[model samples]
Target chain A: MAQRTPLFEQHQAAGARIVDFAGWEMPVRYGSQIDEHHAVRRDAGMFDVSHMTVVDLAGDRVREYLQYLLANDVGRLRTAGKALYTCMLNEDGGVIDDLIVYFLDDTHYRVVVNAATRDKDLAWIGEHAKVFGVGVTERDDLAMIAVQGPQARERAVGCLPPAIADAARDLKPFSAAAHGEVFVGRTGYTGEDGFEIILPGDDAPALWQALSAAGVTPCGLGARDTLRLEAGLNLYGQDMDESTSPLESGLGWTIAWEPVDRDFIGRQALEQQKADGAPYRFTGLLLEGRGVLRAHQTVITVDGEEGEITSGTFSPTLERSIALARVPVGTGERCEVEIRGRRLPVRCVRPPFVRNGEIKINLD
Target chain B: MSDIPGDLRYTKSHEWVRQDDDDRVTVGITDHAQGALGELVYVELPEVGMELSAGDACAVVESVKAASDVYAPLEGVVVEVNDALADRPELVNEQPYDDGWIMRLEQVDEDELAGLLDADTYLETLEDE
Candidate 1:
């Protein structure tokens, strides 16, 4: 049986199109996916992301353990409420999951991981945490909602408790602070300024209603997927997995290579792969024709190198199709992707095809 | 559930055909089919002069989640295809019966239409499955 979020009835009340995603019954879209996508880009939109799992690491050695466990060094989190985005790796130096970790205090830090990888991430953390002696507790008592866009922060402050409303108003990007039972973070997957609110599951519905009344549109997984894709954010299973290393998944920048002496898990394999040079590199494709790019379609460069698209979609802001593909490293500025036996020309460039409600690509 | 008008004829593949007095048959996906496919995104209509076999894929409908092929119900010539859907595909999701009609064919082999199901028969077929 599929699990439901605390705001399941709230989604139903909005006439949402609900579907089973990663074993959880959640809204894929409410009314129109395109409208919801435009809402996040133009104004404000909120999503019930309570299906994601949050783990709190509490102990004297919590920071030490995170530094060793995550590919990105968390040592830079000197101030409380700072958040770090990193990928947890397996022995093969492949991404087990991409997650966000928030440093709350010297002894306490919180990590939010993908819902599909919750069980494995927990077991892996438990098995490897013995040396540091940190206690890992999953926060099932909490539900998370992400309110994102240019106007997101202002609207979300109205729903927050008065004690933390000032703090929330002043919070910068990639920061988190708590007021009473609510934990609000100024972080989001979309390339928009927003806050992720974590509160008791019992208060989720009322807070959702309040936020909606404040002009925050209720978005769903459908809009979330397009927004993240347009922002160049990687999905755990689709972009990279246990077998696909981050070195080839456009995530090499996320890894901390300095202080090579620190033997993080999968360091040796990543080092070797890096030294050998990656054959297939992740690239962004801007479609130049009428056809929309899609995953698993064959891509052939002008020089005859073969590649494949990992994720693709129509960008609402760009008014065109964009795709992410693993292509031969040094594949030049122009490439071609085959759609239904028709070869369509595409341009290769860094992603963020649309950001901050504006088009980054010259769609001429 | 949206009502599938009794005057219309349906195929097992969930397409509805309305025969006019001029002998041109207007075609659209049944309301049930549109309900099964969530919000329609992109649509590919057939060419106006194309000759189609009974089971040939004449058009394509895409939703945000997935894509589906709309097969031709009977052998016919594509007399007209909906140009409005090129820019506004959501018509299939909102008005699958009237404004959302996909195409109209002039020369349909009426003999092959017997294999298609009536409103009650199609509902019964849906129930048996």
Candidate 2:
């Protein structure tokens, strides 16, 4: 049996197609997935992301512990409610998981991690915190909802209480605010302005109804995947895993190498890789032909060197197929993708095919 | 509930078949098939004059989530393919029976059409699944 989120009943009422995802029964789509994808790009749409694991760290040494545990520098998050996106790496420089850490205060911090990696992430954090005397508490009692789009903030404010709404209105991107039991963060996976709200599980259904009434479409994981892919965001367990390092996963910018003394877990291995030229290159691919791009497809360069697609999908915003590929360090502007035994030409571009409800890439 | 036309024959794989007066047979995915697959973004059809056997995978329909293979209902030679679907694959989702017909088959086995399930039988097959 799979676990159900607090919003499962609401999903059923809205005629969603439920599927098992990472041991949880989750909604994949309500009706037309393309329509749901467009909803987030053009207007407000909400997704129940309650399945993600939320853990709170508390202690006098919380910041120090996180600095040693994560690859990115959490010390940069100076203000309260400021959030930082970072990757937790194993000692061998392999990515354990990618997460967002929120600095609530000196003694309190929150981290949200992927659902599939919950067990390992919690165990790893617990083992490391023992030396720092920090307390790790998993917040299973909470539910999360992300409302995203160009009009997302305006419509989402209509459903929140007055104080949180007011604070949320002025919240900067990558910042969060709390009111009573609800926590609102101006962050999202889709490349648009939005809020991610975390509240008590019991209060989820009513809030979902209110948001739906405010004309925020109830989207599902299908739309979420497409939207994030179009935004050039990475999905854990697909694009990277414990076998891959951040240096080759298009996440090198997240690593903090300054303050030579900051001995994060993967520092030695990462420094060694950086000293040598990184062997792999991560880039984006735009299909120049009619077929749809899919993961694991072989990409052959003009020199006959090979690469593979890490993530691929049909971009609802662009109405064309696109992908992210890991190729040799010098793979150039043009390559051919083998789809159905035919080699079709593809153009390489910097990612983020669409953003803020507009096409960011030149199709021509 | 899906729309299963009473006049057509259906395969267990969810394709509908119709026999024309010229002894040719037209085939397309059923309404239930299109609804389950969601909005199709691309369709790959076998070319005209291609030979197919009963139960052969003749076409491919790709939705945003995944791709599904459309099986041939009866053995025949492809006489014509729906060229409009190359640009507008959503036609299969909007009208799976009429404008969405994927291909017309010539040299079809008439006995094979009789073996397919009727509307009532096809609905029962769906219910069992």
Candidate 3:
């Protein structure tokens, strides 16, 4: 049987189309997915992201343990509530999982990882933490809600407790703060201003009801996927997996090469790859024809080289099909994608294709 | 409740058919089909004059969530395709019965039309699913 989030009843009440995702029964859409997509781009929308795994690490050596476990250095998170995005890598430089770590204090930090990767991520973190005597506590009792859009912050603040609302209103992007039992972060997957709120699981349904009563649209994973794809964000399993490295996944920027003496996992393999220069190019593609772009489609360059689309979708914001493809290094501005046995022309562009509810790429 | 016009014929696949006075037939997916598929972003119609057998995959309708093939309900030669849907595929979602008609077949076999389910039978099929 699949697991149910705290907001599952609310989702059913709103007529959401529930589907099995990563062994959990989750809403794929409420009504029209495109309408939900537009809701996040033009106004406020909320998603029940309670299935994400939240783990708290505590000990005097928690910070040090994270620095060694993750590719991105957590040392830069100087202020409490400051968050850093990073990839947990295996010793072979392959991605284990991508996660966000929030610095709460010198001895305590909170990490949120993808739900599908929960078991492995927890086991990996637990094994490494043992040497440093850090405690890893999975907080399944918590539920997360991500409210996003241009008007997201304003509407979301109205649904929170007064004191937390005031504190959350002042939060900068990528920052989080706690009030009582609720933790509010000014961060989101959609390329819009928003807040991700984590609170006790039992209180989630009431909060969802309040947000809906406040006129924030209840969106689902379908809209979330489209919004994230338009923003050029990577989905863990589709974009990169245990066999893929950050250097070739467009996530090299997250790696911290400083503090040369730090011997993190996969450091040696990454250093060797960097010295040799990464071979594959990670980039975005805009379909120039009528057909919808989809993952696993073969991409053929004008010069006869080949690649594949890792994630593709019909971008509602841009009114065009866009994709993220991994191609041969030095792949140029133009390529052709094979859709249904016909080669369609495509333009290579630096992602994201849309941001802050605005189209970033030139259609013409 | 889904709208199922009693006068029209439907396929188990969710397409509705209307026989015209000229012996030709017009076809489009039902309202329930469009609602299930969500907002369409692209529609790939078959070329006019193309030959099709009953149940042939004649066209495709794509939404943000997925792509589905629209099968021909009866054997015929395509006489006209909905060109308007090339630029505005949402017609299938907004006006599936009228403006959203996918194709008009000129040479449909009269015997094949008899095999399609009536509105009541089609509604029963939907319930079974």
Q: How accurate is candidate 3 locally (lDDT)?
A: 0.92
Q: What is the lDDT of residue A312 in candidate 2?
A: 90
Every model's DockQ = 0.42, 0.77, 0.77
Q: Please, what are the lDDT tens digits per residue for candidate 3 over residues A1-364?
A: 8999999999998899899999999999999888899999999999999999999999999988998999999999999999999999999899999999999999999999999999999999999999999999999999999999999999889889887988999999999999877999999999999999999999999889998888899999999999999998999998988888999989999999998988889999999999999889799999998889899999998889999999998998888899999998978999999987789999999899999999998888
Which residue pairs show backbone clashes in model 3? none
Report the C-alpha lDDT of model 2 over A258-355, residue by residue, as the tens digit. 77889999989888888997888888899987878888999999889999999898888888899988888889999999987789899988878888
Off by over 4 Å in 3: B21-23
Q: All candidates' lDDT scores? A: 0.88, 0.93, 0.92
- Our model 2 lands, by Cα RMSD against the true structure, at 1.3
Candidate 2 colliding pairs: none
Clashing pairs in 1: none
User: What is candidate 1's lDDT per residue for A29-73, written digit by digit as tens?
Assistant: 887787899899989999999999999899999888998999998
Q: Identify the CAPRI category of the predicted complex in candidate 1.
A: acceptable
| i-RMSD per candidate, Å | 2.2, 0.7, 0.9
Indicate the worst ten consecutive residues by lDDT in candidate 3 chain B.
B106-115
- Which RMSD values do the candidates have, in order? 2.2, 1.3, 1.7
Q: Poorest 10 consecutive residues of model 2 chain A by lDDT?
A: A349-358
